[model samples]
Every structure is written in C-alpha cells, then in structure tokens.
Target: MTKTLLIGGNSAIACALKKNSDREFISLSRSEGSLDLDGDLNELDSIADIDGLVYFPGTINLKPFAMLKEDDFVNDFSVNVLGAVKVLKKVINQLKEADGASVVFISSVAANLGLPYHASISAAKSALEGMSKALAAEYAAAKVCFNVVAPSLTNTPLAGNLLKTERQVEGNEERNPMKQIGSPEQVATTIDFLLNAHKNWITGQVFPVDGGMSNLK
Candidate 1:
C-alpha cells in the first residue's frame, strides 16, 4: 500500500485527493479534526515510511504592490514557503526511507506569469519553486523526488472571494485560454499522477495545471 502524507487536510484539492485515493492517507493540518502539524513536529517522527507527500497549505494575498505591506509578504511566505520547509524537514528521513518517494508542492501560475494583484503570493510561490528544485537535486541520490504543480484559479474555498459571483467567475474564465475556471478535481488528478509509482522518473519539474493562463495570451 502507498503511504501518503498530506498537509492542509481541509483544502479542497486535498479533500478531493483523499476522497478518490485508495492509498493510506495521513493528514496534517490546523483543522480541529485533523492531526495538527503546528502542534507537534515529533508526531511526524513516528511515521515509519512515507512514499508520497503533498503540501497543500497555501495563501492568496492579492493586492496592488503599492498597497501590499511587509507583513503581507511575510505572512504569505510563512504559510506557503516556511510551512512546507518545516514539514519536509520533519519527514525527510521517512521520505528517504522509501525506495523512491515523491514530494509534490502546490504552487500557482502567478509565480511564473505576471499577474495583477498577486505580488505577495507570486513572490512566495516563486521562492517555493526554487526551493523545490534545489531540494530535488540534493535528494536525487536518496531517490527522493521533489516537484511542483502550478495551478491557476481553481474552484475552491480558498478562492471563494475571487469567484463569489457569476460575473467574477465568467471574468476569470474568459481570461483563461480554455475559457473555463479550473476545478479542484482537475488539479487533484495531476497531483495524484505525480504521487503515483509510474512517475518515479519524473523529478524537479514544475507542471502548470492552469488553463493556459501562464502561457497563452
């Protein structure tokens, strides 16, 4: 059985993955019902072997660069970058113990594409991508693979404010080349693929699950 560790259990994408996945899932999140990563780092030490890890915690702080404060950047970084770093450090050994482990970090298309009102999140995710690549190279000898999945606006609780109304949804859809808003299931499937044994050969890659928003004009 594949042993998978997922952070941010309450996240829509994480929920979708958990529902459809047949693998053994160990969820860590701040939600009252789940194992809290913030409460205990030692808890991760008990996990024997981790075949796959998916960090789902992320922040979306959209604001004009002028209006963005220092705390805005710091807060986003804390959740998106530092949180992943802490979790990975705690479970690195378990990942190394597996024959070939896969680590997937959720990123955003804004990290690569120039988008308005995305200063804070873009910066944080860009740093995350860089960190993932560096760790991927460092852990290659251990047969631990690290990769990132960058998705555009998906229909999720986190993005509720962005898609609150029909006009808002239509606006975002029209912006994407696919003329549609992405679904959590769509992004979740891509993440599921990355965690599968068949993708052992794939590593240090950044996959854009966005509907051509990062590439197409």
Candidate 2:
C-alpha cells in the first residue's frame, strides 16, 4: 500500500480522506502529538519514503481590515505558508524517492475571491498558492507534483464561528452559487485525486472545490 503522510490529519477533511481511501495514511496533528506548526518539525525527519503528502493545517482569522494587526498576517502566514514549507523541506527527498509522489495543500476560496474580513487569510493562502506552483516547477524533474484544493465556507470546526447561528448559516449558503455549504468529503475527494500523482500528469494547479464561489456569480 502507498504510505501518505497527513499533516494536521486530525482535521475533519483529513480524517474523512483517511477513512474513505484505500491508501495507507499516517497522520500528525497538534491534538495528538508535538506537531506544532510554529515549532520544531524534527519529528518528521524520522519518516521514511512516502507516496504522497497532504497539508491540512490552516487558519480562519477573519476580521475587519482596520482591526487586523501585523501579527494577524504573520500568524496566518506562519500556519498556512511557512509551516507547509517546513514540512515539505523535511520530506521532499522522501517524496522524490517515491519518484512519482504528490503534495496536496488545503487552500481557501478567499485566496482568490475578494471577500470581506478575509484580508489576512486571503493574503496568506494566496502566497501559499504561489509557493505551490513554484515548488511544482522546481520538482517536476523529480516527478513530485504539487497541487492545491481550495474550498469555500466548508462545514468544519475551523469554521464554527462563521456558522454559529442559523442566520449566519443561511446567509453563507445563499451567497454560494450552489446555495449550500461544502462538506469535508467534497474537498477530500479533490485532494485524494491529486494525491495519485503517479497515475496523473497534473501539477502546479489550484483546484477550487468552492461551489463556484471563486469564479461564478
């Protein structure tokens, strides 16, 4: 079986992916281990060769532009961009050793869409998307594909604050073109497909699973 490392694997989407996929998944999470995004990632140095990796760590720091501080931007970038960079550096060789491995990142539609109170996260995720494309080009020679899955208003604990009230829920749903919220499985399927890099020639692309919110009216 192909072994895939899931950073922030305890997340709803990651857990859904692990539960439904036939591939072997090894999860690392802050809730279960010392896997702090801003802390040492030395623990990942012990991992061996793996077929794939999916980064699920992210932040939902939403606030008005006036209320946003420099630290807000820094924290968002640390978790969403720097943390992934660190994890990738640790396992790039293992992925290359696999010869056709893939790396999937969890992004947000906010990165592409100009949404209110999303300045910090949008900037961070946008940087992440740019970095993924660069990595994909840098490692194409090694056949290590890098891709991203961007979802909008997903029904996950990370988004509890946004979905706390019925009015908020209805408002969010109405804003989407699909008129509904995205589920963990919906986003998971996209990541799962990208993880099979050995079977597909896809690379350096951002796949939006955002119910048409990113592109459509």
Candidate 3:
C-alpha cells in the first residue's frame, strides 16, 4: 500500500483529496489529526515509510504593499516555505524508502502574476516554487521528485472571506478568463496526479490550476 503524509488536514484541498484518494493517508494538523511535531522536525522520525507527501499549510494575507509590514512577509514565508522545508527534511529518509517518491507543494497564481493586494503571499510562494525546483534537481538521483501546484482564488474555507459577498465573488470571477472561480476538487485532482507514481517523469514543474488567471489576463 502506498503511504502518503498530508500536512494541514483541515484544508479544503486536503479534505477533498482524502475523500477521493485510494492510497493510505496519514494526516497531520494542529487542531486535528496526529503526527504532532510541535515545531520539532525530529518528531517526524517516528513516522513510517512514506511514498508521497503533500504540504498544505499556507496563508492568504491580502493587503496593499504599502500597508503590509515586515512581519506579514515573515509570517507568510514561515508557513509557506519554512514549514514545508521542515516537513520534507524530516520525512525525506522515509520517502527515499519507496521505489518512487513524490512531493507536492501548494502555491498561488499570484506567484507568477502581478496582482494587487497579494504582495506578501506572492513573494512567499515564489520562494516556495524556487525551493521546490532546487530540491527536485538535488534529489533527482534519489528518485524523490518535487513539484508545485499554483491555483487562483478558489471556493475554500481558507478563501471564504474573499468570496463572502456576491459582489466580491463576481469581481474575482470576472478577473479570470474563465469567468468562474475554481473549486478545491479541481485543484485536488491535479495534486492527486502529481502524487501518483504514474507521473514519475514529471518533476520540478509548476502547474497552474488557476482558471486561466495567471496567463490569459
């Protein structure tokens, strides 16, 4: 059985994947689930062999650049980049035990596009993407691949505030070329593909699951 470790179990994407995935899942999150590392990566040493890992912890700090503080950037980076690094570093040996291992990181479309009120998240996600690419190259010999999935505004709990009102939803939908907001299931499907061993040839790739928001307009 393929064992997959998922961080941030409460995330909408994680919930969607858990409902549809056939693989054995080990979930870790603050409020619920097991695997309590408590900011200590060494705690992950107790985990069993893992074939796939998906880091789902992220932040959506939307604000004007001028109004953003240094702490905002730091906090975003801490969750988006540093948190991923900690989890991956700890389970790397376990991932190596598998024939082919896959690591997936969640990112935002703002990483590639210049969007207002997304300065902090964009910077953090860009760094996350760069780090994933570097790790993918460094661990290619070990058959531990790394990839990122960038999504635009989606209808998830994490993005609830952004889509709370009808006007807000319509404005975001109109901004996208598809004229519709994305769903957690839509992004979760792509993430599932990347975590599967069938896509062994794919690595260091940033897949945009956005509704043509990153490129079209």
lDDT of 3: 0.86
Ranking by lDDT: 2, 1, 3
lDDT of 2: 0.88
lDDT tens digits, residues 149-202, model 2? Answer: 999999999899999999999999999999999999999998999998657999
lDDT of 1: 0.87
Winner on TM-score (1 vs 2): 2
Q: lDDT of all the models against the reference?
A: 0.87, 0.88, 0.86
Give lDDT tens digits, candidate 1, residues 102-147: 9999999999998889989999999999999999999988888999
What TM-score against the true fold does each predicted structure earn? 0.94, 0.95, 0.93
After superposition on all C-alphas, the RMSD of every candidate to the true structure, in Å, is: 2.3, 2.0, 2.6
Report the lDDT of model 2 for residue 82: 87
Per-residue accuracy of model 3 over 1-217 as CA lDDT, tens digit each: 7788888877899999999878788887854222344565555677777899999988889998899999989888888888887788788887877888999999999998988899999999999999999999998878889999999999998899999999999998898899999999999999999996325588899999998887785
